[model samples]
Target: MLPKGFQYAGVYAGLKDNGKKDMGVIVSERKAVCAGVTTTNLACAACVKRARKILRRGAAKAIIVNTKYANACTGKQGERDDAEYAKIAEKLFGGPVLTASTGVIGQNMPLDNIRRGAELLKKELRDDYDAFAEAILTTDLVVKKISKTVQILGRDVTVAGVAKGSGMIHPDMATMLAFITTDADIDRGLLQRIIREVTAISFNQITVDGDTSTNDMCLCLANGLSGVRIDRQALPIFQAALTEVLIYLAKAIAADGEGATKLMEVNVTGARSLKEARLAAKAVAGSPLVKCAVYGGDDNWGRVIAAVGRSGARFDPEKVRMNWDGLQSKTVTINIDLANGRESAQAWGCDLTEGYIKINTKYN
Candidate 1:
């Protein structure tokens, strides 16, 4: 379920030839504080640019998203299309709106279809969270969503999120899109800070094919409808709850990677700093050799060691302790001790299989 004061709707946009639900909207009854983090890729989608601009205002009332046409690499026309979508959303929803798109880069968006879909979405706006989740997917096989209620200030605050991604995923922000909604009252600056911190440990620690996409993004909206102001005393609790939601969605994305048969977890400990630990963990998670070894169920700890060695993290191989027994349970935990400090980090990824190659080779 979505947080209070927000309505969601998903409709078939004709952007996808299969007539799948390709457009969705989330509208808040009142203005909400919003913060977003987008892909660092140079070839970003127009929707990403538009969302950044809207977030600069520090608040928003609606979010419009479409899948199956990423609107990336379409040059100036793509920017126009994104602007038009925002305009349409604002006109219909009566407030500022942000936009997001995913799927099929280097192609022009079907503007006419998007316009029609916007109309249908307006009419279908309701509390259909499942439909909204289904509409935001491109190649994803499952709907990734989580909802949790936490007590703050003697009131129940709800936090819910949805995400979509399957392939072209890596650590510099996974090839994924996530939107989180909450009913806790929080300051914009603090909310943004929490989002960045949570993202660093959650979304930034996952990988699939080691290829980042041009449309990756994660956004959060706090509508404060629960009448609970998150003071400093409660910030830690709220942040933990929010992090839990993001980590769940992140793991779901990795486990559901295209043609993935199992999930892999890499742990890096005793690093000199958090940065070193993250670098080492992500390197191991994104290493194709390590991924293949996991897929074959081979006790190839050498590949894991090689990945960490090349990760640019200062580590002492003599102090590294690897445990491959976790492979029997479809989990691989590699502990690398740099013998430098006490910082540690973990990353999640999926094994590479023949099916992954087949899926990507024929994907269009």
Candidate 2:
């Protein structure tokens, strides 16, 4: 199902040994005002660099994505492959295209298949966003998509999003690629700023594995067809809608983390700053000790305490407090209230079971 005017296509590009669906496209009839965020990994993929360059110019009519080889650390060959793919997309869309790539790291792309796949997508672009969602998944077991509508000053608008990733997760921005499209016309500067803010709290707030992917990408496109131009007054409403979509996808990614058996929420409260809170949460969320405990359903609050200690956040351990299960049950009170802190925020993750180990060891 599609949310609205968005058109999509997914097909095999021969980028993997099994000949699974690899190439996909998301397109709009008119240029879409776009904002994108990529991996901060110094070793980013060629496709990541190319997409940023294109979106920097103006609006985009299409997003070309593939899953198989990450096309990272392949040097000059990777750059050439991404350039060729962009050219193929440009010809097919007859307009500017945004490219996104994912899969195994430090690998080269099969440019021939990518070019052929782009041609195929041109012929099949339809209103099937689900097909597009299925095409981009790697280790994920299910396709992720969500859409919502809200009224802004008596005007109706829609926000539709799709995402993929279940492993290599924690890759820059949780190793996922989410493409969102809206019919609202927005200024590029404002759109970029808002997208960044929403993504930081959603996609960037979750993790499974600690490794960041070289080709991570999360982008949103606003074609402004709804005639609801976002003013400063409308910005908060817009950001809230965007953040909701991203957080939904982020939780889905964690729940489906390869072989994950238990979804866990690690919340850090009473921090002096948001950044420190995030850092503390990340440390707790990524700690193997904490994950293993969750896997076994063991209420070991010490694991949480140890995680906080190593979180690189400035905190007086003697004055820190902790809780679990929403701070209601299985709660262990650590009387460190001398530090003057009492608010909380949550991070998403899952247990690191042997099942996860088995799946990653065998997955192609």
Which regions of candidate 1 deviate over 4 angstroms? Answer: 167-174
TM-score of each: 0.95, 0.90
Q: Give per-residue lDDT, candidate 2, residue 122.
A: 81
Worst 10 residues of 1 by lDDT: 166-175
lDDT of candidate 1 vs native? 0.85
| Model 1, span 1-364: residue lDDT tens | 4589998899998887777798999999899999878898889999988888877777999888988778888899999988898888899986788898887777788888889999999999887588889898776788898998888767788889999976432112225999999988999889988999999998989988777788999999999998888888999889988999999998889888888888888888889889999999999989999999888888687998889899888878888777765776756665666677899998999899987877777454
User: Could you tell me the lDDT of residue 131 within candidate 1?
Assistant: 84
Clashes of each: 0, 6
**Model 2 C-alpha lDDT per residue in residues 1-364, reported as the tens digit of each score:** 2345678888887775666687799988788888888888998888889878866875888999988777788899888888888888988885678888887666677778888888888888887687788888876888899987877889877888999876542232225788998877789888888788878777787788887767778888888877888898887887788788888898788778766776677667777777777777777777888888877777677888788778766678777766556323222122222143554556777778897777666454
TM-score of 2: 0.90
